[model samples]
Target chain A: MKSFLKLTYMELKLQLREPVALFFTLAFPVMVMVLFGFIFGNEAEELLGGYGQVDLSVPGYIGMVVGTIGMLSIPTTLANYRELGILRRLRATPLGSSPVLWSQVAAQVLMTAAGIILLFIAGLAIFDLRIPNGNLAIVPAILLSAFSFFAVGFVLAGVMPSARTAQAVGMAIFYPMLFLSGAAMPRYIMPDFVQQIAGLLPLTHVVILIEDLWLKGTWNLTSVAVVAVVLILGLVISRFTFRWE
Target chain B: MTQVIEVRNLHKAYDGVTAVDDVSFNVDEGEIFGIIGPNGAGKTTTIESVIGLRKPDGGSVSVLGLDPQTEARKLGNRIGTQLQEAALPERMKVWEALDLYASFYEKTVPWEPLVEQWGLAEKRNTQFGGLSGGQKQRLFISLALLNDPQIVFLDELTTGLDPQARRATWDLIRAIREQGKTVVLITHFMDEVEALADRVAVIDHGRVIALDTPDNLIASLNGETQVLFSVPNGFEAERLEKVSGVTAVHQHNQHITISGNGPLLANVAAALAQHNIAPADLRVQQANLEDVFLALTGRTIRN
Candidate 1:
């Protein structure tokens, strides 16, 4: 436990040192939130379900945070560590592969949470959005969703051959999901066919789950099941095929 | 002598092609063992297997009486490795890396001294990516010795280092051995082995071709000292072969070449004096490990 904590501390410090990771995990989400607020905050029209744009856009930014950290930040960081033999160097010590990989996930998970908080503060200050009912209930849902997305990152960390490939693969998946899942724009603006396709992707589910929790103050039990299944599948695939090269 | 590491008939392959086959070696306590070979000759692969980085197909590897494959975690406390290509987090500070690596061991030496000893005291606050190549190499050597392991493996450790830094690293390695630690040095640089190895294993095609001290390996190749000089116009240069200890003599234009095992230069000088031939452009060349390697493999170590 001591060693794991030490590893986690170092991992978090190292992650914070990376400008690219900082951009994806923290600054990007905050940027998106402020932009969404400025563009659509003051209007009283119903853009997201029944709330104003600022209230609706908060969940989308959270989903974007998860997506950026899971798809772009975590996978690319792991791939770079592997390709550059940072993982191999650790293997020579008492701290083996599992601890190092887990440390990365833990660090990114914390960063995702921090990004969400930043988005929340920015939302409240800029758009005058209020916190929804049942503030404590959001923690479990956020954790499960983060795990579900981190599991997806683990799969990318396993399959991608290089950091460049990981980045390429991450961007390939991230942008489309962001646009289609209503993370980049209001979901009401998306066509019905686009919304159906978005529903099939995991990011859309994350956004909806966060949206429902923040707006309606109730659990979306069906989205929880979907996330649980993905979490298991991602774990299995990554465990079986993860490469140290 | 205590054997710190023992390997028997290790075999490994990748993607249906053999990388290491039938390789075996032992490292005794407190000795610098060098492994030198041409590219793709499986030197790195052999080291990886012995260090438990790979699972061997056919043989057993034991380090400090523990199975490397099964007891790597246990062995990790006793051994250290500096891989051919490795890096820390780019923005990690020097002191942070030293302290972090120090934490991996059950017992650790004070890292403050390591920083001073390695000439990295001022660079402690500098990020890893900001360091020069030599500074990075010094940092790696310091990190490898951080745990004060009983045995250490270093592979291609000084490939890009400057000459002064390379010399410092060699001295640092010797200092490690002076503390009664064992080392396994893998490098393609013959000069590095010649300067540092107590004994070297010459590997080729995944097999140990010769295992002996550097002097013995060069001697076993029948390497000869050569005497080259331009003979006075008409003096018979070939006649120097009759002088004791000269084995082969050849003449190209006015230059006479005399090759022999021992004291050939003295004998040839005497023979020339006897003939009253004034030798000009006098030169003597002794065979080195590079020449021995070329003779043994018929190929250069580097592409």
Candidate 2:
């Protein structure tokens, strides 16, 4: 346990050094929240099921945070580690490779939580956003959403041949999911066909799950099942595809 | 002498294509054993197999009396490896890397002194990517020694360093041996083997072509020595050819090369003096491991 904490601490410190990761996880979501909150007032809107734009957008922004960390940060960093033989180097030591892998995951999870916290602070400070129904429930909601995305990220990193390819493929998947999954805009505002497509995306389920818990203090069982299935499926595929070197 | 590492008939193939075949060697304690070969000659594969980083398709490897495959974790604690293409995270600070790797082993020398001893005291806060090639290698050497392993394996440790850094690294390697640690030095540079190895296994085409002391390998070439000089306008090569221990002499225009055995340079010099022909550019060249490799493999080590 001590070794695991040390590894995770070191991993977090290393991840914090990356400017691109910081921009995406810490700054990008806050930027979007401020921009959207300014355009739409904080008053509860009938269109958003009586939730203010700040309240509704905060949970969707959390989905974006999960996506950015899982789809961009995790894949790019792990793939680069593999490409540079860092993973193999650690594997040669007496500690083997498991500590490195778990530490990386733990660091990403911490970063995801930080991004969510930054979003909440922005919502509260800028727009007088109301606190959610069940404050205690936010922990599991954020964790499960972050975990599901990390699994996808791991599968992408596992299969990508190089870091550059991983980044490119991650961006390719991320940008589209970001826009169509109600992460950038509300699903109710989109056309019917676009909403149907959004329903099929993993991020859409994440956004639904987070917003349901934040506003109603209840789980969206369907979104919960979809996100859970993605986590399991990603894990299975990564088992067959992950390459250390 | 105690044998710290033993490998017998180790065979490894990738996708049915052989990378190492029937390669065998033993490393004695407190000696620098070199595995010298050209690229793709199975040098890395052979060492990786012995270190348990690779699983051999055939043969057995024993390091510190433990099976490398079955007891890899135990063996890993006793042996340290600086792999050829392995690297740490670019953003990892020097001190952080030392501290992290130090945590891997059950016992370790304090990393602060280790880094200072490796001349990285000033670069403790420097990130891995900020280091020069030589500094990076020094950091790796320090990391490898963190556990104070009984045996250390270094693969291509000086591949990219400038001449001065290469020599400095050679001294560091000698220091490792001076600490009573058995060192496995792997390289394609014959000079590296000649300078440091107590015994070298010359690998080629995934096989151990020759294994002996560097001096013995060079001496196996009939101990041939060459004398070369630029002669005056019309000097007869026959004078030097008739000298005892002179096996062959070739003259091209103003240049003459004499190949022979013991004291050939002295005999040729005596004969040349008798003729009053004192060539100012005269020089003696002794056969080295490159020649031994060429003679064994029918090709130069590089091509």
Candidate 2 lDDT over B194-254, as tens digits, reads 9999999999999999999999999888877999999888888877778999999899988
Q: Write the per-residue lDDT of candidate 2 for residues A1-245, one digit (tens) a residue.
A: 55678899998898789888899989999999898888987898787777787788777898999999999999999999999989888878878767777888898998888888888788888888888655677678778888888989999999999999999999999999999998887788889999999899999999998888888888999999999999999889988888888
Query: Residue A148 of candidate 2: its Cα lDDT?
Result: 85
TM-score to native of every candidate shown = 0.92, 0.95
What RMSD value applies to candidate 2?
A: 2.2
- Show the colliding residue pairs in model 1: none
| Residue-wise C-alpha lDDT for candidate 1, range A162-240, written one tens digit per residue | 9999989999998999999977787778889988888888888888788788788777877778888888999999998
Question: After TM-score superposition, what is the CA distance of residue A49 in candidate 2 from its true location, in Å?
Answer: 5.2
Candidate 2: the clashing residue pairs are none
Those runs of model 1 whose alpha carbons end farther than 4 Å from true positions after fitting are A42-51, B228-243, B248-256, B265-283
* Model 1 interface CAPRI class: medium
Q: How accurate is candidate 2 locally (lDDT)?
A: 0.90
Of the candidates shown, which would achieve the greatest DockQ relative to the real structure? 2
Candidate 1 lDDT for residue B18? 90
**Model 2 chain B, poorest ten-residue lDDT window?**
B232-241
